[model samples]
Target: MNARKVLLAEFLGTLLLLAIVVGSGIMGERLANGNAAIALLANAAATAGGLYVLIVLFGPISGAHFNPAVTLAMKLRGEALPASLAAMVCVQVAGAVLGVLLAHAMFDIALWQPGDHVRTGVAQWLSEGVATFGLLLTIVLGIRFRERAVPALVASYIFAAYWFTASTSFANPAVTLARSLTQTFAGIRPIDAPAFIAAQLVGAALAVLAARALLPAHSSVRR
Candidate 1:
C-alpha cells in the first residue's frame, strides 16, 4: 500500500471516529433531558455504529486503526512497519484533535477548552487497563478466526465497554488526549489523561502477550 494512502485513510478514519464519539455525546446530553443513562446509551450506540462503518470503509486501506494502541499492537506483531506506525500514531492524534474541534463546531461550543471532568483513581485506571486489554484481544482474535467480523466485534466490544468500565472505556490513547480538549459528556480532565494512557499501553502490551500464547504464529486455524 502507498504510504500516503495509508496515512490518509488513518487520518480520515480517526477523525470521523472522534467526531462520532464527541458529537454523539454532546447531542445525547442535550437531548436526554438530564438523564445520564439515556445520554450514555445514545453516545454508546452512535459511537458503535460509526466505528463499525469506519472500520469497514477504511480497513482495506489502513486496517482502520484509529487507535494508537491498536497501531502499537500491530507494530509489535510485525503487521505494521516502524515508519508507518510512527506516522499513523502522529496522524491519528492530529486527526483526533481535529475531530474534537469539528464536534465543537457542530455543537456551537468553544473550540479550544480544557476539560474539567475529573476522572481518576485506581479503579478508573484498572478499568482502562481492562478495557484496552479486552479491545486488543478482541482485535487479534477476531482477525485470526473471523477476519470479516473484526469491525462488528470491535464495535460491539466498545459499546459494551462504555457501559461496563468506570471511565467509559477510553481505550484509545489518541481519543484520551483529544477528549481532554472538550468539557462535554465524553471529555476527560487533562490531568487524568496520562494515567489512563499509561494503563492503556500496559493493557495493550499484555493483550499481545496473551494472544501470542493462545495463538502461535505457526498455528493455522481454519477461517
Candidate 2:
C-alpha cells in the first residue's frame, strides 16, 4: 500500500508537470507576437511556478520525484526502496505521456504529433548533463540542510537553466520522451531523445557520487 501511494504520487505529479510545460509553451507562443524569447520566458516562468507547487504538494507522499533522474538518484541514495524503483519509473513515463496528450487536447492539436524540433548537438547534450547534475545535487543537499527551501530552489534552478543551458534544461528522461511526442514549442525530435536521455543518466550518476561525497548520509546533525 505504501508503494502504491508512492506510485500514485509519482504518476499524478509527473502528469501535472508535463501539462504545465507543454501547455505553457503553447500559450506563450500564441501570445508572444513572434518573439521566441518572450515565449520562452513565459514558458519558463510557468513551469517553475507549477514545479514549485507540485513538489510541495507531493513531497510527503513520494518525495515528489517527477523526474526519472530524481527517482534513480533517490534509489541510489537509499531514500527510495530498490524494489519500488522500477514501478516508479514506469508510472512516471506513463504519466508523462498522458500529460502530453492532455495538453495537446486542451490546445486543440493532434494527440501525438511527433516533434521535428531539432534539439540534438554536442552543446545541447552537454547542457543536459550539467542541468541534470545540478538538479540532483540540489535535491540531495536540500533534503539534508533546508528541506523547505527545496521547492523554491529547484524551481528557480530550472527557470534559470532554461536560458543558461543550450537544451533549455530538459533534464528529466520521462519529460524528454513525452516532449518528443508533441510538436509544440517545448517538444524535441523523437530521434534526439536517446542522446538527451543518455546525457541525463550520466549526469544523474555523477550527481549521486558527488552528493555522497559532499553531503554524506551520516553528515546530518540536528541543531
Leading candidate by TM-score: 1
List candidate 1 segments past 4 Å from native: none
State each model's CA lDDT, in order. Answer: 0.94, 0.92
Clashing pairs in 2: none
lDDT of 1 by residue, 1-223 (tens): 8889889998999999999999999999999999999999999999999999999999998888899999999888878553467899999999999999999999999999989999999999999999999999999999988889999999999999999999999999999999999999999999999999999999999999999999977656536
lDDT of 1: 0.94
Q: What is the per-residue lDDT of model 2 for residues 152-200, given as tens digits with 9 covering 90 to 100?
A: 9899999999999999999999999999999999999999999999999
For each candidate, give its TM-score against the true structure: 0.97, 0.96
Model 2, residue 201: displacement in angstroms? 0.5
The per-prediction CA RMSD against the true structure, in angstroms, equals: 1.2, 1.5
